[model samples]
Target: MNLIGIFGTSGFAREVGDIALAQGYQPLYIARDQTELDAWSFAGTAILESEVEIYREIGFAIGIGENAIRQKVARRFAGQLKFINLIHPSATFGQGQRQIVEARQGMIVCAGVRFTNNIQVGDFGVFNLNATIGHDVIVDDFVNIAPGAHISGNVHIGPRCWIGTGAAINQGQGDTKLHIGTDTVIGSGSVVVKACESHSVYVGIPAKKIK
Candidate 1:
């Protein structure tokens, strides 16, 4: 069994652990501290590599709070770490299915249906349930795409972005490369058509870029 160590013991971490086990990996709970990690390593338990690779593998960072402690720990242990991917049991991926595509060990794909080559989900990104990602789209790391969102084809979402619930990107015609910058927020039920810069909040039709 591939022993998978979780960085945190929070509810989110538990949820991730469940997925890890379902994916045929052995899940071990580890505190988000260097001492605990060292202890676990000393105990001959393999630490899960989830720092740079998770961020680098996926487009964004999941479970990253404002505090820098976790980041520091991850950086310190990245060399000996092993990252893993978490996919819901209900999720499916195959040929000709209209949905998003996450890279190898990339993105947290929740239960949902996706099209063939519709969305390119970056490493450590998240797609909540029941969301539809259209074809030829790019989603960067640390992105949070809420449930029931409809993303059309040829759209590009940057890293650390959040696409809110029931939002529609590239709804209807006017096919273009819709870009959302890093750390951007798309409000609920919003429609985006144009390109967005980093750290912008967008809402309404045509998606005005707000600070």
Candidate 2:
């Protein structure tokens, strides 16, 4: 049986392990130390980072949610192990069909998600449960779209940005795209209509930058 290693032992790591189980792979919990491994009730084998070389033909999925941490973990195993994209089987394509331009490694797409045409997703992007992504979207690396968030067409989300739960992005009028800058955070339930600057936090119905 092929073993799928999940890096991190948090609740999210367990969730990813369940996803791996659904995909028919034996899930192994990978931790930095024995104490971290002992904290989680991992049913399968728990191994430390130093012991990773013992396993061959193993695929890895980052269980960390934070962008910076996930990026760091991904870098540590890049080219050394194959990254897995864990998508729930129930997630659907827009219009009953769509074509993704590019979807990189280590993406976790949860159930009831919809992806429209011409979407480009970078590495380690997380789309939580029931998130809807519209057409012509560009999602950069380590971007997290929270549960039930609606990302409208022609929207560009930058790297390490977080779209909070139930947030929505508007499709900008004719030929214009809504651009969300890098390292930004969109608050929960906010409706983003215009372009946002880098390293800022935006909130409210119309999505104004507060910081």
TM-score of every candidate: 0.68, 0.92
Please give, for residues 50-152, the per-residue lDDT of candidate 1 as tens digits.
4334323222123332223444544565545545556777776546432334343334566664544645566556677677777677877557777788778
- True-structure lDDT of candidate 1: 0.62
Q: Model 2, 52-156: lDDT tens per residue?
A: 777747788888878889999889888898897888787887653333412468988877888977777888998888999998888999998988999999999
Report the error of model 1 at residue 47, Å.
Answer: 11
> Which regions in candidate 2 have their CA more than 4 angstroms from the true location?
95-103
lDDT of 2: 0.85
Counting only residues 3 or more apart in sequence or on different chains, how many pairs clash (N, Cα, C under 3 Å) in candidate 1? 21
Scored by lDDT, the top model is: 2
Which stretches in model 1 have alpha-carbon errors above 4 Å? 33-77, 94-103, 113-115, 171-175
Pairs with backbone N, CA or C atoms under 3 Å apart (clashes), candidate 2: none
Candidate maximizing TM-score: 2
